[model samples]
Target: MHAPVPGHVPADRVFAFNIYGDPRLTEDVQASYQSLHRDAPEIFYSPLNGGHWMITRYEHIFDIVKDYEHFSVREMQIPRIENPPVFIPLSLDPPTNLPYRQALMPHFSPKAVSAMEPKLRAFAADFIDEVLARGECDFVHDIAARFPVSVFMELMGMPLDRLRDFRALADDYFKARTNEEIGALGERIIGLMTELVELRQKEPADDLISKMIEFQVDGRPIALGELQSMLFVMFLGGMDTVTNVASYTYRHLAQDDALQARLAADASLIPRFVEEGIRSFGVINTPRLVVKDCERFGVQFREGDMVLCVLPLGSRDDRRFENSAEFDIDRQALTHLTFSSGPHLCLGHNLARMEIRILTEEWIKRIPRFSLKPGLRHHSRVGTVIAIESLPIQWPV
Candidate 1:
């Protein structure tokens, strides 16, 4: 059926590294991507999730992602062509996608994020205060998971009352045991978004939803479906990414006391510490659909085939990075595909950074120092975003 797997990659080299489960991330899951890069050929076929070609090095991924004509980001799941309604802007490629990004640019800009700092800090403080009195906490649920979700709820003007319900459903969506289960949870979220959109239509307000409703593409308001899809993307992303990266970063810090102490001593390094954490632990290996039959990096692909641009591999490429495995916060000017490169670079990056930076600052200022609870292990899950599930941590009060 498919053009006999690309790159002449031996059936032996092809591996199913269980993007989400296997070799579950310890101190850092990006290590798994690095391990994949070091061990496999530049390109190999894996029958893991319905047999897709995996790119190991950064060079190829950079070129491929920028050139979307050959590779489409429309599909993420393998062996399964399931759709819970694709998110817009992200799903749209180039020229057309630019306008949608432009419309939202102002809301996510540095200036806008700076203005929101007070609210962001307050949210962080509220959560930290709840845990500060208690010497120990499950950093994953108590902080990492709720912070971003709550922020998104406030930002999008979603009902404040439903934040907890939405967050729980989202958590379940990622950790769902079966495809059907994830599908059901996804539908519930989408249904709620539909209701929110209807309410906003009759009575608009000062929020992302209203802002989006004002934008007209080619002199026409965005279709309800398109608008809902964009909102869905924002909701889905807002709930997950920061939670994942924050947990992973803290887990790394939890294990390394010296680094943790250094960060506490010099809060100025928090930004770089956050940057390096994102670089090494950016756990998503973004998937793209092969729209038409073509050859890439010495491999032939067919229409409908899938290619996974393992972002972690690109970010940790040894050829471009020295000591790629070692987590160095003060490393020379960092270059990475952690937020992705090219057209699809994460638009929410600014907000995501602000959240992580503030949280790191707050943690260092308050905790003095902390570590993973004894005899407990940290775990990570892979889906749209790679999140550390439960980071049990303890600090002397």
Candidate 2:
């Protein structure tokens, strides 16, 4: 059932699109989102999720995300909760958010990510090897989910033994419904992070967490609150986004024999393939709080109202991408809001790209041919992140 529309929202602008549990997401997530572009206004209000605005067009999303002055990042979640979990830099607006983001740049920089490529490649190959002999496997669970999580665990110095536990928590957090459920899961996550922070404080190690604990923001040592917030966001990013993207992209490749052969034959095209895949199957829905009453994008946005930037829709916006729906590896000037844009642009994009590139390169090098097991209908779940819940594929033994 839809929530009552607010007085400020025009009747034409109200569209009951539920970002979290929309039925169409399970059938075809990207196509489900694309329908909004055809059916709804560029910017409309959704009576679901406590009545918030949905920004479908690319230009408007770009402008709103960058305009921190107008659209604040303070309360990003829809169906607004009391005292939501804090994600450092992400939840903080510009100027205030800048220093924390700057401190993180060197760590996630192209150079730093390059340094980790060997380990990333090894992790990818190892996971591939585990499933390669079987000739049939659930790609999403067997490889897509485990690979990046393992790499992230190694980077953060988390124990491999707890990989499943941590992954489960991350999964639960995303799938959680209701404010209380989300909050409870968030606290449990923070509880885990708090332990790690305390342990790192006592025994400093050569890891991302230890390095971050040493970061100084505004000429002062980062406080515990800020440190926990940074780690919290890192945990979420490290665990989920890449996994979803990998599943979606591979599912696409599994269906298209020609595209799979092309990438397998020419490893050089793998990078372009990664870029195009991310653009085509981008999986993040970022929300922003309308800071002050404003008249922009030809609509009225009241203060404290939440606005969700439908990021995947932005990448597929025809105004920016020619033949945006078609997945063309040769598409030139391929820029997208997949990693978002502006001050809060995703910090881990370099690592995410490298992980996906290496994994694809390794998979194609080994299992050069594979496809969805016949008659298999993969399941998907959509929330802040859209994911293929299961993907069974097979190849010649």
Candidate 3:
């Protein structure tokens, strides 16, 4: 049911888009978003989720993300919660966010990600080997989900034995329905992270957490709250985003025999394929809180309003790209907002790209020809992030 549209939202600009529970999403996530581009106003206010604005066009989203002065990252959740869980740097703006972001840059830099390529490649190979003999596997559970989590575990120096438990928490966090439910899950996550923070405090291992603990932010020692918040964002991104990206990319490849064969034949094409796949399957739908009264894009904005930048839609904007919806690896000047734009642009994008690229190269090398398992359908859970719930895929032995 739609909430009452606020007076500021013009009658023509209101759309009943529930980002969390939209039924059409399960049918075809990309198609549903494409329909919005073809049908809805460029900037419409969805009455659901506490009456927030949805920015559809790439031009508008790019501007809003950069204009943090008007569109604050603080209190980003739709249906705006009271005392929402802090995600640090993610939830901070400008000079304050810059320090923490800078502290993290070196670790996720292209060079840093390149140095870890050998180990990452090994992980990809081992994961594929585990499922190769079966000739069929639920790729999301058996590989896509585990690969990135394992990489995160190694980086954070977390015990591999707890992989399943941690993965479960990450999954639950995304699936949560209400503010109360989300808050509870947040506490559980923070509790788990707190244990790791305390452990690094005493032992001081050579893990990412240990290095972060030692680094000074803005000429001052990082406080405990700031540390946990930063760790939370890292854990959230590291554990979840790439997993969904991999699943969606592979699912696409499974259907496109020609595309799969081309990539397998020429490994050099995998990087471009990865970029195009990211563009085609962009996952995140991030929210920005309006800090002050403003007006733009033929609409009026009130202070404290929530604006959701539909990244997937923006990347698929027809005006921005020729043939925007199709996943064409040969597409030139590929600039998609899958990693977002501006100061709050995704910090872990380098790591995410490397992980997906290595995984694709290894998968195509081992299993050149594969497809979605016959008689099975794929479904995705749409919330802050769009995630494939399960992906059953098979190949001949």
lDDT of 2: 0.89
Comparing 1 with 2 on TM-score, the higher-scoring candidate is 2
Question: Could you give candidate 2's per-residue lDDT for residues 185-212 as a string of tens digits?
Answer: 8889889999998999999999988998
Runs in model 3 with CA error above 4 Å?
A: none
The number of clashing residue pairs in model 1 is 0
TM-score of 3: 0.98
Candidate 3 — which pairs collide? none
Task: Rate residue 255 of model 3 by lDDT.
Answer: 92
Clashing pairs in 2: none
Clashing pairs in 1: none
Question: What is the Å distance of residue 110 in model 3 from its true position?
Answer: 0.6
Encode model 1's per-residue lDDT on 230-329: one tens digit a residue.
Answer: 8877887888888887888888888898998898888899999998888877866678888877887677777777788888778888887898888898
- Give residue 240's error in model 1 in angstroms: 0.2
* TM-score for candidate 1: 0.92
